[model samples]
Target: MAWTRLLPVADLPVGMARTVRVGLDDVLVCRLDDQRVHVLEDVCSHDDAPLGDQEIEGGCVTCPRHGARFDIESGAVRRSPAPVGIATYPARIQDSWVEADLED
Candidate 1:
């Protein structure tokens, strides 16, 4: 397991998601409630839409293209219109910076 620094914790606003290219993967890093961080595949399972540009509500993010809702923590497809689920990455905080590990 290799970890790469994504961004500073302060760079992400609460309840918002940001897109970062880690290695060759496009990952979405989200700052949820309680300043918890979640990292997931930026692509939406419904039609391969990027979730970084979508809208986030509560702990879920809605795909802007097809309106698919997914849980940021578990990568679960909470709403229909999307039958598949996206990949999730493990994240951690170190020295006020957010980092994520993805199997490449």
Candidate 2:
């Protein structure tokens, strides 16, 4: 598997996510519950809006444009208008840094 270093773990706060560029795509990397990190496509499935600019609550991030909600853990579109699912990247914390695998 190919792993790309995204950011230092200190840069990501628990319960929050940040946008990182992987190749030509922007990904939302989330540091969740002090356990695992989740990476989802930054653009919302609805209207192609950016999910990173929206507020994060519980485990979901809402789409700022159309109010579509997405579960960060699974990249599931929990709300409508975003009927399609998002692409997810495997993520982990290694050596005090956050790394994501975009090989898939």
Candidate 3:
């Protein structure tokens, strides 16, 4: 897996989502808490809308375009209108930096 360092952990606020570019792919990085973070594809499966700026609530992210909500941890479609789940990348914090495996 090609793990790319996205940003420092301090740059990401807890309970918020940030969009980072790894090559041509746009990844949504959600910092759930002090010890957990999730990385997901920044696009909605249903309408191809950007999920970057969506709000993170209770481990779920609500798509701003059509109100489709997805679980940040598993990338599962929690609310309908989204027929499929989005892609999730493995993420880790090392040396106080957030890294995401984009190889998959």
Candidate 4:
């Protein structure tokens, strides 16, 4: 898989979700802690709403449109109203930047 550098780790504050355009996809990036970060698609599975800027609840974020909570790291569905899980990318911190492999 190819890795694309999204943004600097310092720009992503903890507990805040940021949206970045990667190719034709809108990617959601969130930094949970100093050593933990997550990358995923910015769309909700239930109603196609943007998942960006959602508040972090532990390791998950709830869809504002439908209240469907999903794990930001693995994209697993944690609450109802979502029929499926979101898409998560393999992410890593390289050279002080957050990089993600969007090609999957």
Candidate 1 vs 3: which has more lDDT? 3
How close to the true structure is residue 96 of candidate 1, measured as C-alpha lDDT?
89
Per-residue lDDT over 39-74 for candidate 3, one digit per residue giving the tens place of the 0 to 100 score: 999999999998876558978998889899999999
The local distance difference test score of each candidate is: 0.84, 0.83, 0.90, 0.88
Strongest candidate by lDDT:
3
Give the better candidate number (1 or 4) by lDDT.
4
Q: After superposition, how far is residue 57 of candidate 2 from its true place, in Å?
A: 1.3
Q: Which run of 10 residues does model 3 get worst, by summed lDDT?
A: 50-59
Q: What would the per-residue lDDT of candidate 2 be over residues 48-89, giving only the tens digit for each residue?
A: 987774346878888878888888888988888898888888
1-104 in candidate 1: lDDT tens per residue?
78889999988877888899876778998888545888999998878878775446978988888788999999999997889888888888878888888875
Candidate 3: C-alpha RMSD to true structure equals 1.0
Point to the candidate with the largest TM-score.
Answer: 3
Backbone clashes per model, in order? 0, 0, 0, 0
Residue range 1-104, candidate 4, lDDT tens digits = 78899999999888878889877879999889888889999999998998877558888988888789999889999999999999999998889999998886
Error of 4 at 58 (Å): 1.4
